[model samples]
Target: MKLRRFFCLFLSVACLGGIAQAQDDAASLQEVAQRREAQLADALERLRTLRNDIEAQQIPLAQRLQDLDAQIRERQREVERRQRIRDNQSVELDTLRQRVSDRQRELDYISRTLLPEYFANYDASLSAGERATAGEDVRQYNLFLEKPDTSETDRLQHSLALLRDSWAQLESRLGGKRYAGEALDPEGRVISGRFVQTGPLLYFAADQGELAGLAEETTALNATVTPLSTSQNAHIVEVAQAGRGTLPVDPSLGNALAIEQTRDSLTEHLEKGGIWVYPILLFALAATLVAILKIFQVYRIRHPQPMAIHDIVKALRAGQRDEAMRLARSQPEPAREMLVAAVEHSDESVEMVEEVMYESMLSTQPRLERFLNVIAVTASAAPLLGLLGTVTGIIKTFRLMTVFGAGDPKPLISGISEALITTELGLVLAIPALVLHAMLSRKVAGVMARLEKASVAFLNGLSRKSLNQKAS
Candidate 1:
């Protein structure tokens, strides 16, 4: 029993040793696992920190890229704006240059058309007249008496006239059929409608709203004035008389017909007084008539009772107050006004009297310049009216073209003709009106100067009389 008890004790001691060894092994494994877990956690923390840094860097990079793109877009817009400004400026400069070039070309064309060698000769002749008038004894003073050797010019004129007839012939062939019921033209010397055979003269109802006289007073002139014919002796007088009724209808014969038709149409239009040109022309005529009548009236007043300074001085020296007043009343214009004012200032001082006379002269000057503004207005407005008429005619022509597509030239040419005729007439009227305005203005100035001179002379006489009286 003691041995068995000793064996049990040994077994218990071995089991205890085994359990202790197992516990130590488990403790070592746990230590190794904890070390590995700690290292892994540190590595994971490092990776997370690196990921956050990368994300932060990406945000800044994205912002920088967006800012760079915005800068580039702004630069492009600025460049485009500058380019547009430059383009607009260039276009404006080009337009201005083109307008200047066109104006220069127009001026050149006008100068070339109007100024020829013959124009130079005419200018030289005019200069010669001016030189003679300026008291420079000109050699060409009698140029008007000397017959001008115009043979070449006359030949050219004759050829031009023949060419005009040929043009008329061609025009008649193209447009004569349209003008069947037209009246005769007084200026064109055409006999087409309303012909009346009087003894030697062939009276006709003309385009002028009045009867037209025969083309010529002499029978010999009638033969030459007739239109060209194609007979064997068409140029001969005898042939013209023999072949008057039996001649073929040459193209030249249609010249009169076409001209008469156009003249009749134009005359009918003008007589209607519907165009602006007609009223303008009537106004100009009325103005011119009034100006002429005023000129005649002024001439009558000026020539009959001219007040001379010497006569007035003698009257003042003689102390003939009643005679001076009578002379002043008989005188006209500035002289009468000055004398009346001077006589009214008998009790006044010499300076006061002189001032009164000057004031009176100044007041009369405006009266002398009466109707001058109207002339100036007419001269200035005439050209504008012409431009208006031209514009109207051009508009009418363009309107006709829009409707007709330039199919017929009659209406178009008629408008152009009216435009040209009215323009020419306006220029003609305006040029003369301007000249008359200048002349009248100069005359008024001269009259004012004469009145001032007379006033000065009277003042001098009064001063002399006062000094003499003081000395006495």
Candidate 2:
């Protein structure tokens, strides 16, 4: 029991030591908890201070960020706007390129078409003296055009040179210019001469002051001039040398000299009228001759005088048969013939008298109308002949065009002249023939009417005794 009691006492002492240690541990815990509470309060205050500082800084930062965002949007929009401008510029560049291409095409067309035609016409229109200096340039220009693969640059250069030269020549010549050149004399001798160029006319005055006249161009493009009258040559020499005399004044600007120089004579003009012209001229001649004959024949035709017919009727009514017959004889041939028949048949019935008068009229009508159908035929045929000539001329023109093309009008000139001349001749012949035919027909009708009136008067003037005797 004693041992058990000692163990109990020891257990109690250990238990009491454990309880004191536990109480000390609890106080240390309270102190540690107090220290931790103070630290927590300090941490909470620091957190509140940091949150206030962050809120104050964040306002300006948010405003700065929003401003940056707005600036970025503006820069993006500016970039888009610039891109659009670039796109428009690209379109404009394409348009410019297209315009350049079109200009190039136009240049090519001028070289291919306008240049050749202009040079050809220029050579045709200028006198040989004026064209002599330009021949080389024209030849070279034509060569360039004919070359299939010629560059545009070469063509442009040649065209500009030719155009400038032509313009300069025209400008200088229009106001009258003098130059030295070689010309062919009437005898085909080459002579040195001073050339005076005035518009389309070129005059060559010899250096020796001998031959002077208007300069003409040959098919070979040589300048040829024949001498004028002695006085005229002297005058032209004076004008060419001294530069003080008047050229022939022209009302048609400066074209009259050219026209006068190149004027075709009647024979030359007729020759240019081609093959159809011969027929037209023949018809015109035939019509003229026929018209003359018809005029003479119709104008000389005799018709009875009114007074002579009246006297015949009075005699017939007065029963003077011999007097009536003598009056009928005094009248002109056609009226006398008809009246003589009526007087002879006066004792017969009226119907029989009428038949005899009608027969005489029929006989006389052929004489009055003799060759009248020719005049009518001529008037009707002239215009038809002209139309035929015109058709033939047109056919010739087409044939020439087929062979020579329309580039040179000279080849076609003959056909055009023929067409126009034939039509003009036709109209001229037809109009006069128609007028002559109308006048002749009127004359013939007047003569016939006079005969008819005399016949009627003779029938009315028949004696009643003569009629009653016929009835018996």
Candidate 3:
């Protein structure tokens, strides 16, 4: 019990000590709370000061921000107006550029195509004499267009001048115009001559009256004069001097002259047919020779009379074998050969006799058909040669066009015309060849048929005769 009481006493003492410590902690906490409350009051007073300062500044700040916002909106509106103006200017600029481009295209067409074409046509229309004067102007106009620094205005102005001059020249030439120019005489010397031009016709007369005739352009600027008769030359000189006499007018203009100039004799025409024409002509000659030979040979072939054949059969049937043989020998050579063979083989059977005569016909077949293939080959080869010539001509024309251009169709036309001449020659040669071949072949066939007919007639005579007397 005493121990229990002591423990209780100690517990009480510990509890009291705990109580005192708790009280001390409470006091210190109170002190801390009071100090914190003072700090809070100081903080709240500073906050009120800061709030008042901020509020004082906020009014002017807000007013400045509002002014800045108004300024920004005004600047944005001004920028929008500037942008609209810039867009409108862009449209106008594009329209003006388009107009400039369109005008440039028109200028290009005028300078490159239309004006050049006009000048070229005008140049073509100029006479050889007029070309002496107008050719310089046309050349100058061409140079103007070709110049890099030449302006559109200058080009157009020069073009107008050229066209005006060309038109004036044409009009003056239509009535009649006399000009002094250089002309190529027939002697190949250039002579100073007076030229009389009327429309498409141009004439030249040497100052000495030694040379005068129709003037033809050998080149764009050069004229070659074809001297007329001596009497006509005097007349041309008189006309060229007076400018009022009759100018010999060719209704066909230069056409008649051109035709006359192009004219060739048969020999010359054949020569111009080129190298292949020789072989073609050789074939023609060979075919012609063979045809003549064949025709003559065919003509010589026998046509045995029916009555002549009957007499031999009569003699053979009447036991006059020698007389029959004589009669057979008297027949034409082709028939005589076969008849002799048949008579020599008369002792044989009828089949043997027919075979012998047929063999004889076969032997003579080569002679009858001799050289016929040559004619046929010529007929077949002529057109091929012509076609070959045509191909070569086309090739030549293309080659010339490659070396020179096709600006002048004369080379192309002349080449084609010369090329077609070979074809013409070929057709001409082939047609007659084919016809003669047919006719000759027909004659040979007729002769062969006659031989066969004679053989058949002789064989029939043998059939009607006695087989018993054939041993002789």
lDDT of 1 by residue, 1-472 (tens): 9999999999999999999999999999999999999999999999999999999899999999999999999999999999999999999999999999998776555443433333344333321112222112222222321346635445345434433543453354332111112232434454333322222222222333333322222222121122233342232222223322222233442355457645656566553322767756875986697578557644544521333555655676577877767766666775777777886674478999988988897787767777777777888887878778778778888988998778889768767756666676678788888888887777777777777777777788777777776898
* Better model by TM-score: candidate 1 vs candidate 3: 3
> Candidate 3, residues 9-61: lDDT per residue as tens digits?
99999999999999999999999999999999999999999999999999999
Best-to-worst ranking by lDDT: 3, 2, 1
Using lDDT as the measure, name the better of candidate 1 and candidate 2.
Answer: 2
Per-residue error at 109 for model 2, in Å?
26
TM-score of 1: 0.44
Error of 1 at 73 (Å): 99
* TM-score against truth, every candidate: 0.44, 0.57, 0.57
Error of 1 at 116 (Å): 46
lDDT per model vs. reference = 0.59, 0.80, 0.84
Q: Backbone collision count in every prediction?
A: 0, 0, 0
Q: Candidate 2: lDDT over CA atoms?
A: 0.80
Q: Which residue pairs collide, candidate 2?
A: none
